[model samples]
Target: MMTRLKIGACLTLDTLPDHRDWIFEADRDLELQDFLSHAALTTDRDVLIERARQALDGFRGKLSIHGPFEGLDIDNKDPELRPVITARFLSALEVADRIGARKMVVHSPYTLWYQNNLHSYPGYAETKLARIHDVLGPVLRRAEELGITLVIENIQDVRPETRRAMVDSFGSDAMALSIDTGHAQLARRMSGAPPVEDFVRDAGAQLAHVHLQDVDGHADRHWAPGEGEIEWSAVFRAIAECEAPPHLVLELRDATHIPAGFAYLRDRGLAV
Candidate 1:
């Protein structure tokens, strides 16, 4: 049974071995989520990427990787701090490149705090973009060189246009947008951010990747799709309208529930 739109799952090495057959059964796309951690990126990175690359030898679908984001900011104000951030992202991109990933998902730098206090300083938005470029500039070049696109996933971004500008500032084909439905919904629920649907609509063709987890609109639930409050129909409708299309990944916390999530969307004719 072919999916209405191609969909995939975010998998860790632990789950990868068990699900490799399922992953190939229908040629589903894959997002390597484990490399987004410190343990997988440092000290043990070679062993990790080698194992994942070996296991995915026959995968026919597109590939992506989830880059590290914890405690790192792409737009760090300190010029001294920007290099460290850049190093971290470049390391993650190395993993993505080695694994032959088409895209790498990086966390957006925008925050609810930054958006709320836009008036606190002059040229806040412009400075933010400049800082981001200072850090991500080299990483972007490296990504383009490796034939990999960098997709910025929304975290505390209440203002989607700001994310748009950050992506636009690079003006490189390697830069694009990603939406984590759960995070967008949590921002809307907690701080009046735009709904998840709006994020999808705004990204339009430039939307290259998506983390398709369902949330309660209260927190980062990462639940199976049908269990959450998000309007799946509207979300998929907007996704269907995308001009560039995207890799839809079921990013559930429990890999066991991924089949359930895929079924939920498939039953509704949203995916396979």
Candidate 2:
């Protein structure tokens, strides 16, 4: 029998206060502050490595790492902020290397400016393009040398052209795409963004990872497969048709949801 697609949780090892505010209510006993601090400190790398290994035990699926999403900026214009981003990525890399993970997911710096702005100004696209090259150039180059794959994700209607542009600029097999399903849904609903299949195809040779989640037309719900209205069968079909099957990560909030999601994929004959 063919194996199932990998299902993994996003570790909010160092989330921002605003995001953690909701997580507290979702998982009351998680001790968010302590976990974040522990993940931030490298003295505990072995412990973190074991935790990830344990998390994947008995599972015959590939593993991938989601680096610190909160307060991480690969495209920061300030020289001071670059090291902070690099350190966070390196920490995640250490854990991933320990667990034999093949891909590390990182977001562009769009969230920093797009959070408050309601309008899409003229020069915004050009500005973000320049920022992406400046911020991710060194990091992507180093990732190539280190044999680590860095997959850049799209957020808030980041144009497909821009995504293609960034990957072409890097021109390295180590650099690729991480397509977030919910984010793509949100972009389609809110901004009339192009279809998910189109994005995947456009990404072409650089598409290396995927984040699967279900959401309504509004906020990201992160619901289990078949629990929400997403057309998962279509999504999987698109993935199957890709030139290469990128790593498919469930990106669920909880581990409890993983079994059901796996079952759903199995029932659809997509486990392989």
Candidate 3:
């Protein structure tokens, strides 16, 4: 039977092994902030594209690109820095296009620092959200034009509602949620937020992508699904109940865990 969801593993330079049958989530390695700082595009761009093609060769499966998210911030308060950020994002979208990627994963602009200082500035959240919308608008339009779905993953988002509200405000079909199970578990332990299953349920229809890793509830361990204390059964069930199923990627810390993670999901009848 063909599952409604697609399953894959996160492929870095080191893990581009014999994954010919599974889908892939390719990570962009070029640090765009550095490129933007140096104003050098030709050599680096050529190398990035060549390496991406080599890494993706012989893979007959769907592809998604993990957009550059190291030092770039879409919600940066600095006016001058916003353009640089947007330009770097545009570069990432270009890479996605070259690779024929169907979707891209971007980290949410919200952070735990904002939540901690929520009371300091009464309208800070609104201001940050507005800036994020403005910064991401062009990138989202480009993704839509390229037939790509830009999935926003939660990093420091303690409350899924805040992220959901931000995504809903755009009202664009090109943008959607990419839930990271390990991050959610860590947030629940560190900030008293909801658990992993609750996040999946809350995301519901908005969920379009997922990092199906597990954690010990204290830190982002990024272990295989069944190796940690997370309730895999409950999480998968919540996902199954969603109106739109999401692409499930085994974002394990170690590549060796990939086979075990797939087996664990298969045993539970949640291969996708």
Model 2: what TM-score?
A: 0.75
Clash pairs detected, candidate 3: none
Tens-digit lDDT track of model 1 for 101-157: 889999998888988889999998888888888989999999989999999999889
Q: Sort the predicted structures by TM-score, highest score first.
A: 1, 3, 2
What's model 1's lDDT at 153?
96
Clashes of each: 1, 1, 0
For candidate 2, write residues 1-272 as lDDT tens digits: 33344333454443323233322332311111112333543677677666645644443444466666676666667778777766666666666566666667777554424533526676665666666666666666667766889888877644665666767777788888888888877777777777666677777767788777777869877766777666776677677677876876566666457557757877877753
Q: lDDT score of model 1?
A: 0.88
lDDT (tens digit, per residue) of candidate 3 on 30-146: 111122322323347667667677867655555677777767787988888888778777887787778667778888977788778988998997899888977898999888898
TM-score of each: 0.96, 0.75, 0.86
lDDT of each: 0.88, 0.63, 0.76
Task: Show model 3 residue runs off by greater than 4 Å.
Answer: 1-6, 21-42, 54-60
lDDT for residue 268 in candidate 2, whole number 0-100: 78
